[model samples]
Target: MILFDQIIFGPIHSRRLGLSLGVNLLPIDAKICSFNCIYCECGFNTTMHDSPIPTRDQVRETLDAKLHEMVAEGQIPDVITFAGNGEPTLHAEFEGIIDDTIALRNKYCPTAKVSVLSNSTRIHKPHIFAALNKVDNNILKFDSAIDRTMKLMDQPVGKHINVAWFIEHLKKFDGRLIIQTMFLRGEVQGEKLDNTTDEEVEAWIQALEQIRPQQVMMYSLDREAPTQNLQKVSVDELNIIAEKVRAKGFDVSVAG
Candidate 1:
């Protein structure tokens, strides 16, 4: 039920990425996402709204000004993040925007990293993959490795998508990407769901082994979920899962 109302909204402290400055390429007044996740902080996708996606030029200009301003205030962000009301990759000019953001970050605060939070739905697209590779931290969502659990959790808008499809494209990263997983328990549409079960965790670990990411980020709901029945996984539980991932000889970061 929360929405960011600006193109350049936050330099807020992020649990995973510190001092994060956000860029919202989607409409400021409404959400535009490929997945209508029950636990999305922005709530369900908005079907109707007049707000337009910002032009490439507009994003460049605004981001440039904001970065310049932050530099002047001696508040250099740790990362320039492409995340907000909805899926940032959905923007037609996403690649060009990443190009612009990189230039601005270099000019204003060269040390700051550039990151994007994506749902991993568009990684197969040539342009999106290229753009993602250019960023410092290409964090992607992989909430569950099981087909049924994933469908119930992510609620992807694309009917053709399945766990098989995700594993296939994700391996394309070739260990260059960061896999982000959210662990939680709840019931949605009258079915019990929990991605933390032994079987679920085991399946997810197997998937991660194949994906071979450079690192893994694990966390639970830090904010209220739209689905009222959802429960947050305890920090201890998260650390346990993180340890399992660590045993696989992969770098893991926990943000609970």
Candidate 2:
């Protein structure tokens, strides 16, 4: 089922939203993201390419045409999410897309939310922060609070990135920030790693409290990953950690 996925792919059932329509802003031939996490489903980044950037007008045109068709067919969705092969924020006209997408949704289906599943690499950009503030939900990634484990798990693009600095930046965002974490056990580069341990989970909770995100979405692998050694954490383990976050008065959801 993997090919060049069109601009919209599901009203596929989602745990949080009943049905979600995806928006793919990156070029279809290769995955585009700042971090090459071992568990990413689109596979790893072989080389960086910058071509075929979708213009704001094109995004509006494609999305409008799809929404019009969906409206006529009465196929309403719970959300219109910015998620796809890679990071949606990488799109040059991200702010424009957010503005246009919200306007189109209001015209066609006002009940549907404009949401984004971003990695939070570009949250430092004032424009990106302002754009994300307009969305109904801004789900950002924060896999591990420890620097050494973060490098092992996320494999970020540059050496300058620090977890502490990222956490600080996220705290200042003037919108609802939903933190997303992927819990798993794996061996990468011949080294064994586990992120579901008590100490690791405690550190993550501390970061959540410091950032004070509006919500948290915790889940494990659901598709084939680039790293085969990674094992999905069980529901029981997820619930134990989730309860700890919930006790701190933060809403948490365990997605399958």
Candidate 3:
């Protein structure tokens, strides 16, 4: 329901990241994420689009202007987040864009952290990996560690992207990244699905232990999902799970 019409928008308060400024690398009129998650706020992906993805120079200039305006207004963002209608890593100039963003961030809002909310699909690429490592908070999505649950929930565009694929690549971060998981329950095509189940949670914990991320971010549905029968996992349930993971010495943050 929400497609960011501008290249650089927001400075809105985020549940996970504070006073955040958003950056949309995909087309302004269409969604181009690698994963067609049922809970994506902008709905499913659109193949056709009227506008093009912003270029590196355009992003840098517009972001510079925005940061200048925010500075003049005395309203600095807590984080400059790369998130919007779709995946930011898919952009051809993503590495260059991150470079420009870091420069602009240092020039305008030195204290503002640069964060990217990726689906953990493109991190296998050397350039993408380098770019993510450069960011202050490289938040990646790993909704379910079970292959079946992940395929059903995330519906990754690449058929090869299974739980194992994620684990193998996520481990490459080597405790430098943060893992973000969405906890929820529902039925898809008459099949019952719930990541909170003991089996699912245990497998997820195992994957986290292997990755050894610096922190883990857990949250449930905050917006209407495109599909039906989806149920939101409550804050109490999230905390219950967080406690188990925390026992394993993983710093977990819950945004309910």
Model 1 per-residue lDDT tens digits across residues 88-155: 99999899899989988889999999999999898888999999999999999999999889989889
Predict model 1's lDDT versus the native. Answer: 0.92
lDDT of 1 at 198: 98
User: What tens digits encode model 3's per-residue C-alpha lDDT throughout 1-256?
Assistant: 7899999999899999999999998889999988999888899889899998898889998999999999999999999999988999999999999999999999998999999999999999999999999999999999998988998899999977999999999999988999999998999978999999999999999999999999999999998888889999999999999999999999999988
What CA root-mean-square deviation does each model show from the true structure?
0.7, 1.7, 0.7
Worst 10 residues of 2 by lDDT: 1-10
- Please give the distance, in angstroms, between residue 100's alpha carbon in candidate 1 and its true position after superposition: 0.8
Those runs of model 3 whose alpha carbons end farther than 4 Å from true positions after fitting are: none
Ranking by TM-score: 3, 1, 2
Off by over 4 Å in 1: none
Could you give me the TM-score of model 2 versus the true structure?
Answer: 0.95
Over all chains combined, what TM-score does candidate 1 have? Answer: 0.99
Clash number by candidate, in order: 0, 0, 0
TM-score of 3: 0.99
lDDT computed for candidate 3: 0.94
